[model samples]
Structures are given as C-alpha cells and as structure tokens.
Target: MNATAVTVFHRPPDAESFEAWLDWMGETAFAAEGFVECCRAVSDDPALEPGFSVTFRSEALVNEFLDSAARSRVLAEGEALGIQRKSSDLVIVEGELPPPGVGVFHHSVADGKAADFVAAEAELVTLSATFPGFEGVALFCRGDTGRWFSVLRFRTAQHLSDWMRSEQRAAALPALRAELTEDFSVVAHTTPFGSTLRTVDGRTRVTPTWKIAMLVLLVLYPTVMTLSRFLGPVLDENGAPPWLAMWLSQIVSVALMSYILSPAVAACFRRWLDPVDGAGWRISALGAAIVVVLYALTLLLFATVKWLHYWDYNR
Candidate 1:
C-alpha cells in the first residue's frame, strides 16, 4: 500500500489551551501502530485555523483509526478540553520527488530594507492559491548563510508553470528584486536520492535495463542450477548436493563481487563514455551494466570455486 499523510487545519477559540490540547493529541495519536509521525503548529495568524498534520503508512490504516472506538473517545476528551472541529479538506496524491534537488532564485534589493522580504515571500506562498495544483511553500532564511530558500511544491507540472508565467507575479518581482544586494540574485538545483525511498520524496529506483537483466537472470540461474542438480544424479556423483551448493555459491559470489566492484566500475565507465546527459539514461545504463557485471562475476567466481572443490576432492 502507498504511504499517506493527512493534514487538518482548525482554528481554536483559546490559543494557549488549544496548543496544549494539540500537543496531547499528538502524543496520543502516535501510540497507534500505523502512526508514523505528526506535527501541530500554529497557523501564521490567529485568524487562520491552527494546523494538525498526521502521517501514516496507508489509507486503510488511517480509515481503521478514524472508524475505531479510539477516535470516538479521543473526540470526547478533546471536546472536554475545548477542542472543536473546524473545516477540513483532504488531498490524496501519489508521486515520487526527484532526488534532493533544491531550486534557488534570487533578486537584488535596496540596502537597509529588510521588511520587503515578508511581502516577497507572501507573494510566493500565495502561488498555491493563485496557480493550479500548487501544493505548498517552505520558506527559510539564514543570517549566517546570508541567503533565502523558498521551496515550492506542486501537484502538477502545469501548476509550476502558471506561477512562472504570471504577469502579475512578474510585475511584483521588481519589488522583491529591490530588497536584495548585488550578489543576492542566484538560483541553484540539487538532486538527492539514494538509499531509502520516501513516500513524499522517494521514487522507484528500478530502471528498465535493470528490470531486463533481472528477468534474464531469474530464468537462467535457476535453469542452470536445476540442470546441474539432475546431471549430478544421472552421473552418480556423490559428495556435495549440486543444486543447493551451486545456488548458495552463485548468490554469495554475486553479492561479494557486486559490493567490491560495481560502483568503481560504473564510475569509470561514466567518465570514459560521458555520453549520457539525462538522469534517466545515465541511471538506466549504470543499473544495466552493474547487473550484467554482477551476473558475469558470479559465474566466474562460482566456476572457480566448483573447480577447486572437484580438484580437492580428487586429491
């Protein structure tokens, strides 16, 4: 099942009491088996509803929690604590985020004008409402870094383009540009995807070439081992069990050689060829090459080991 997270925004009557209640709810909800994490943060203004974000692994789990008696009891306790339900909207989406890439854009502004940054980011944040399929904005400022990062998430490619092309937003850009110094105007994109796959951020790691190689190996490996097993019985050979020993030998050799040489070999090829520019092609080629090398190395290692076994037994 795909991972899912639900966010509920509600305005509470009492600010202090509402925050305390949210904290309690957060702790209580996390005790559930499917709960991955949750956060309760005040909205930008008291007028805006306070926000509660709950993360879970599956929709089924979320539904189970909502339908259970636990939810009823929790609602009762929350009501006693003065927490009331506000308007809620649910967004369901599934897609992988590109590697840890951050896009940066900057504009110059007048000196000693710091307040303009607020108006600037406010405009950017509004793109979610202004443009189609805009998800949200994460804006950050670092005095030490002397730079601002505004990360925008969108549900579709068209949504991203809408903000980029809006003439009204373009007109407002000058005011934003007026707030930065000479070196402030800049943009950068960085990709970070490796190891663990995340629901919001992680995408499929499998490539087409890798898929093909795996299919070939799946058939070839088992067939060869099965044939070897039958041949051993027909030849009346005795000692090690052919199928089990060969299968174990193949798996071990492949893993060992792959760990030792795959990355280095792939890097060498990348440097030498330098033909692939797109991420998809580069990744696909690397994956295919790695699988082929792994399979070939497995055969070499397993054959060497088997020959050694035969010679040792004969001696």
Candidate 2:
C-alpha cells in the first residue's frame, strides 16, 4: 500500500535559508527509494506552521527511511535552524536546513557592541546570498546566557566550505572579528566513509558490519603479508631502521588499499557486500562462510608453503 508522511514544522527565522534547503531536499528526495512525489505547503498566516508531505510506494519503504542514518543526519541540520519536528520523514518547512552549515559556531560579541555585530551580520547575510547553495542565516540571542548566536545553512558541505574559505569572507573577517570578542568559529563534517556508501531508491544503507569486517580482513591481510614477504627484506638490507621500514611498508599497503585493492575487492564482492542487493541472513551467512574458508586456506598456504616464509623472521 502507498504510504504518505506529512511533517509539520515551525517557520524558520530565516525564510531564505529554509527555502534553499527545501530546494536541495526536493532534489534529494526524488532520488530516494519508492519515491512517488514530494509536495510543499506554505501557510499565509504567520501563526500557522508550514509543512511538507512525501509519498512513497509503500508504507514499509517510508518506515525504512525513518529508521535510516541519512534522515537522522538531515533532521539534525533542520533542528539547528530553529526548527522543531514530530520525529518523522521530511520537514516541509513549507521549507529547513542541511546541517548547521558553516558559520556554525557562535561568536561572543564585543562587550557593548552587540548592535555593531548585528549590523555586521546583516552585511554577511547579503554577501553570503550571492554564493551557490547558500541557504539562509538565523541570528538570535540566547535567553538564558544572553549570548549572540548565528546559524548559516548551506545546501551541502562543499558549498559551506566554499563560502567559509572565499576571498570575500577572508576580507570581511577583520570587520567581523572587530565586532566579536573572540575569533569566528566554524564546524564541519570531514568523514570520508559516507561517500563510499550508496543511496538506493532514495534511501541509503550501510553494508552489514560483519560483511565489511570480512572484506577488510580479506584485502588487508594479503596486502600486509605480501608487503612483508617482498618489501620487508629489501628495506632491512638497505640500512633502513625497523620503524622506517615498517612505515614504508605501511605506506604501500595503504596506497594499495585506498587506490587498488579496496576498490577491486569491493567490486568482486559487490553483490555479497550490498545491504540492499544481498541483505538476507542466509546470503550474509553464505558470504561469511566463504570468507572463513578462504581464511583457513590462506593460513594453510602460508604455513605449508616453504618459499612464502623466507622473510617471516626478517619482517
């Protein structure tokens, strides 16, 4: 059965930011699994909260996305924009945020210069709007501690980083810092694993943990053993210290893993390593069993073969 999830969200303080995020989200949502259509709703009355609705091919698919990491990560961004949610898929915002985006950290304004900072912030908002993926900015004062905070929302991390590092921002920093008691701060995500993961039918799933572990072991073991067997002796004979030799060997292994073996290995086990394509418990077990057999055979070969062990002690 087709399932529809309608989410209601409070209006973001920065309407421009919310609108930009919704545009980005609409593009992302269309790529999700079982996607039917996504529609937006805006309320004319300021008192009513704005919202959006999403439809999926099945209730199950909608449920799956709600449980996925991608949604959680996106929701965290929306919340940073002064948005509140009922804990479901897709905030309509009638519009919302992508992650706190850069210009994320709050700066302590210079004492008695709060008004100056406010003026400076407006200038920044104007400047930021010219950039691609620039969402909107939210500025407010914390009631409890009475600190000034600003939230900038961008469509993606790349977009945010670009703005933070732009020459315009660099030039504006002197003025921005003049209004702040402390240096401007930025927080960004730097993890690379997310790029390796796949987003299928608009939902993303990480390969099962056990499957990943086995694959890593499968590639890493041979990469390390072969390097030790071949390269270790050369380094040792050339007056390289043990640590230096090990470091060199490690460099080669990592290069192989990053550029060669990891990609080749992942491709070889494509079906087995896929959470969506081969996710059943039976398939998982079968894949794991094969790895176990290989492990045993590898151990036997390394142990029984006399020539492969020539450099074992030297390594």
Candidate number with greatest lDDT: 2
Q: What C-alpha lDDT does candidate 2 achieve relative to the native structure?
A: 0.63
Give the Cα error of residue 43 in candidate 2, in Å.
32
lDDT of 1: 0.48
* lDDT tens digits, residue span 1-315, model 2: 455555656677887777776675566667689877655543333322355556677767766665667766666877787667532333211101223333434577767886677667777777878899985555644443425545555677677778876889777768778877666533222111111343322234567676777877877887787788888888988999998998999999988887777777676666677666577888878878988888888888878886788555554
Clashing pairs in 1: 99-192, 100-192, 101-190, 104-187, 108-177, 108-180, 109-178, 109-179, 109-180, 110-178
Q: Pick by TM-score: which candidate is best?
A: 1
TM-score result, candidate 2: 0.39
Q: lDDT by residue for model 1 over 153-258, one digit each (tens)?
A: 4565455555566776667666566677753422211111112122211122222243433534634563455444444344335455666656655665455334
Error of 1 at 104 (Å): 18
Worst 10 residues of 1 by lDDT: 188-197
